[model samples]
Target: MTVSRFYSPQSIAEATAILRQQSGCQVLAGGTDLLVQMRNGVKQPEYIVDIKEIPGIRDVTLTNQGLTLGAAAPAQSVTERPDIAAAYPGLVEAIDMIGSTQIQGRCSVGGNLCNASPAADTVPALIAVGAVCHVVGGEGVRQVRVEDFNTGPGENCLKRDELLISLFIPRPGVGSADAYLRFTPRTEMDIAVVGAGVSLSLDPMGTVSAARVAIGAAAPTALLVEEAAAAIIGTTLEESALAALAAAAGAAASPISDKRGSAGYRTKVVGVMARRAAQIACDRAQQRQRRAH
Candidate 1:
């Protein structure tokens, strides 16, 4: 057995320097995914750069701007924050549903994002809320929208030398809320066949003023369904509006059939999930409206 060399860096610069010198070095935020891949022979890394000890990567901070979620921040850490839970419940739901109860404490959003799995629950949710990824490297820091972060399954826009620092989500406006839902073969420990997330802002007149709809596991990457979002933007999510949203969602998905579900089935089911998620978001938006008055 070849022993994998491990380095735990306290600073971002130090970490990047190590990565710059090494080839095929794996960044360990939460080892939940990395360890599994390694054991399964899917990944072979000579060096492991552990960033959980880094100052900014493990913290969950709530500010007036929004949540500054460290890339290494555990799902449990994010879920435990009452402010984050209250602010982005849809994100909280996605983060919390990563794995089993015990695994959540060790699963980081960064790991989930970096894994770039098509079925990742958090990707669609992140897109729905317009989160940005802050990545750092020897070259410098750069920001990317979460929606554009993933290029394909098991691939992302990150260069080998770069590391994600944190995720930033702007504070939702008043009368705004979000929701996430996914269909899986099993309730727990099963990958999603399809996932849908919706975030919407309601005007005082109960019309959807702003909205975002994202679908996951139905394409090469998590897809931002602009047409689906447009369907409900100027109207309440009535059945007619929802029907249009579902139609758009179905048209946008390009899934491949597998043991979990057929391509056609996934396409149809994702539309349903999108409509359900939209309804949940709209309901929550109304609740937010009530709370503000």
Candidate 2:
């Protein structure tokens, strides 16, 4: 029997060294996913490196670049920032929907992301807002786009000795807004069967100038559907445009059958969620425009 080694590294350098030197070391951010995996025999790390005490990783900072969410910060803390909630309501909605209130207290967005569940709520929202992740390791720092971060379910792009330090999401500009929606078996405390996130920028004339559409629980990984965005751009998202958007989004999904939902059901629901989420985003964008005036 191997005894699990626990480590509470107070700095990135210390954590990186341990990860590089140890044969099996896993990061312990919120331990939301780590503990579950350990119990299920999915992961058996010899070393558990607690990084919550790492100076910069637990602090959320707003900047000209946008809102920087420290990887170690709790999901609940993200909603407490009024400025961030106002700027990126869709992200806040997604972050807030992660598990229940108690789970939110301990789960970090970074953990949800790195856990790489196809049903993770935040992935689509992050992709819709063009979020970027800052990763640190023995080789130093690098950035990865949120859309490109996860390779598949229970898998991520993180290499050995590497961990996400922070996530950066752009601040919504004037006439810009976003929204997220998910279909679940239950009203609350349920995994998303089909999730959609939409972000858009509208011109003064009410036509979309820029747009992003992303879907989760509909593929091996959450995906940014550029064609769906193209379907609604340059229009007020009329029925014709929305129909196209739905069709394109539906076409992008390649889900597998599961107890939560079947592949066909997930595909159809993604189209409906995509259209609804886009409409909500469009409405929010118009509201932002009015607020700006």
Candidate 3:
């Protein structure tokens, strides 16, 4: 297996052009996954377009609506952003668990999504937060919800000529907090056997207003457990309600038996993770309200 050609484009437009002109061209961001895949003969692209040099793709800034993160932004950048940590703590936790410090320095969120691994840590958290991906191609630009971005394991909805531009993550409301939790055999540097992210907003009266729960490594793509989330709406956090939500989340999961874990084990952990994540998120939301006061 040999990488025959390499192209480093300075601009998004140039990158898109090269993608349109060449066949079997794979876009390279941090090369954390692509390089290893190529080395393992899992991927052997004729043209490797290095997009790291492209400008305007690494900016991470706060916007009025929320945070606009450049696709090329490193995972460490997101994990370290005060605003991201304050608004979406789950996202911070997910990114922080992606890999070691060295891996975080070179891995980008865009790359994580593009790699389209079912065990990708950031996907579940981003999906739970209602994050949207901005994609640009020869045709134009469009936005896709993170939940719909990945089609299956190691597959995404990106067109052959499309380039992921950025991610638009809306800031949580005044009384909102999000948390991500995962279960793995090891504490770190291990893929999640089961993962869950919960984002919830509480009303002034302490009732649940909005809720989103997403689970990963339990299905082809990270799935939003709407029924599970709905179980908590219009109610205060209670053990019974949390248990019901957890049951729903477990039912919603479509895990398969694999080397990492068994389907039964994954399903059980999905429930446990869902309940724990919801409780953690609610606690964080309450804390945020207290801080604001």
* Per-prediction tally of clashes: 0, 0, 0
| Model 1 Cα lDDT, one tens digit per residue, 1-293 | 14369999989988989899889798988899989988989988888899988897888888888988899998999988888888999999899889988998999998899899999999999999999999998889999999999999999998878899999999998899999999987888889999999999999999999999999999999999999999999997788999999999999999999989999999999999999999999888888889889
lDDT of 2: 0.92
The list of candidate 1 runs beyond 4 A from truth reads none
Q: Per-residue lDDT of 99-188 in model 3, one digit per residue for the tens?
A: 889999989999998999998889999998999999999999999999999999999999999999899989788799999999999998
RMSD of 1: 1.0
**Rank order by TM-score, top first?**
1, 3, 2
The superposed Cα distance between candidate 2 and the true structure at residue 53, in angstroms, equals 0.7
lDDT of 3: 0.91
Model 1 poorest ten-residue lDDT run: 1-10
For candidate 3, list the clashing residue pairs, or say none. none
Which structure is stronger by TM-score: 1 or 2? 1
- Candidate 1: Cα lDDT at 240: 98
